[model samples]
Target: MIRAVPVLLTWVLAAGPAEMTPLVTEAVIQAPPEELWRVLTTAEGVLKLGVGAADIDFRPGGLLRTAYDPKVPLDSEAAIHTEIVAYDPGRVLVTRIHRPPKGFPFMNAYARVWTVFTLTPEGKGATRLRVAMVGYGPDEESQKMKAFFEKGNAWVLRELQAHYPGGR
Candidate 1:
């Protein structure tokens, strides 16, 4: 009765932006965390994701880069820009993407994105690996990216699992 309609609209407006649906995935590997950590911190391992040409320093704030041509397939790229945001030996590795050359025209149009990987030791010579990534863009566009990361992480887990001493 006393401007109740206005009050309801104000409450809805104050709810703020919707929570982002984070892209996450996990895998259990027969390899030790140390072995997995090495691959996670190196350039050769980075190539598997089709991210970019990598020059990884493997330390906190260390340089991580990948380069690729915008016109060609991403895997053929010669360079891509990335930075090491966090590096916890044998446990976690996180990086902020600077400029992604391969994912252009669709995935990496807006703000920067970050990827984090956590490795937990499991009983009897096994490890639990988790990957979490966040990306920014309009909801419609971001959804496509979310799906990409989901599939990519799945492929990564499969590849890593195969690399284990005794295949699963």
Candidate 2:
């Protein structure tokens, strides 16, 4: 006679080491630096890149809000809010996500996180775009958030690459 025993299966996923470090991703966009900068700074350009509808105030100490639903108001529950920390025309743009949507995972944990886009002319009619996400703390939540942004940013860059004219 044999007795059946119940078996339980569990899986746990982690974002690896808790060290505070910046996650950097880069891509060579087949567009001029000025055009790439416009894509990074303008609402229409962002919409073309498929991130969602954007309401961008492209300046230092300005607001950048994005919502998937165009009908939603900028301050509505569906929006993601970030502050423009700094910008150098056709060179760099820095933004910090100070207010993520309510109930978002690790929302409170991202108070210090920043996303920076740097562009440089890579020769005739091409630009090198580098994105760096910084200010992740040494904690599970921060690590998880960092990993999430790393993937998300990579997708954005890929989208930019695909959307730009002459990009392959």
Candidate 3:
């Protein structure tokens, strides 16, 4: 039987009362940080992990554009847009989702969401990856968005783990 490991979830409130809560998920991938870094930073690697075709420019303020549905033409207005907020090669990367796909349910309903990926090298060839989705407002729509991404981010991490079975 394949036992499933529960994904860890946490919440952090911003300093002020008006601040929104941040949703965090963490996982330990059985692969080197470098390999996972490539998956997160490169278009080809991201495509291999099933994030759809991507046009990634891996630098601060660069774009990581993706089309989630292959049925939708790449040039169509269905691509989701994210910008790199900060990055440190194989260690850390921060990105903000600035634009949702056209006609998305929550399009333009909430503030931009910041996703921070921190990779820490674990024992010989393992990496602990922590993904934080922040900047959610204290509104119903924002809470819905947070819940949506909490599951989505966890699935992305699982896909990354599957990409490196038994650390290859």
Candidate 4:
């Protein structure tokens, strides 16, 4: 059971004003949108997350598969597979978990969540990256899942920002 890996998802810009606020994280990177796009849509780029191996099908309905254990094959149950929901070149990318790894906690709440990444050009070869996680239900479990993502997603964006340090 994969009880310790970060979860992923995308969709629902806002559940509703009456609902819980979505978990949104943002960072400014020292790279162009195209540069970031390359990393976002490629296997090597995702490995920056410290995964062992990954394969990306970068299109709507495509799959982004990853395994934290380098020795594990992508097709194995320990890998995580996310479905690309929608994307615009160097602009926005959204995804939802197509199939979670074994032993993943929060299956019920996990299925209802999604994640979206937005890229905006900041002056001087920099891009502002914003990630939003949405679609949480109003329940204790949902709240827990949401909290988990708030930290996980923020950490991911930080890692990405680090990837393009000092206007690289």
Using lDDT as the measure, which candidate wins? 4
lDDT of 1 by residue, 55-86 (tens): 57766667666553334433444345566766
C-alpha lDDT of all candidate models, in order: 0.65, 0.75, 0.73, 0.78
lDDT of each residue in 60-151, candidate 4, tens digit only:
78999999898888988989999997777789898878898998887777777778889999988988888888778888878888888888
Which lDDT value does model 2 have at 70?
Answer: 79
| Poorest stretch of ten by lDDT in candidate 3 | 1-10
lDDT of 3 by residue, 23-66 (tens): 88888888888888998898887875567678787877788888
For residue 65, model 1's alpha carbon misses the true position, in angstroms, by 3.2
Q: What is the lDDT of candidate 2?
A: 0.75
> In candidate 2, which residue ranges exceed 4 Å CA deviation?
1-20, 166-168
Cα-based TM-score, every candidate: 0.69, 0.82, 0.81, 0.83
Query: Per model, how many backbone clashes are there?
Result: 9, 0, 0, 7
Instruction: Please identify model 4 stretches exceeding 4 Å from their true place.
Output: 1-20
Q: Give the Cα error of residue 4 in candidate 4, in Å.
A: 35
Report the backbone clash tally of model 3. Answer: 0
Cα displacement (Å) at residue 52, model 3: 2.1
Model 1, position 102: C-alpha lDDT score: 53
Deviating ranges (above 4 Å) for candidate 3: 1-20
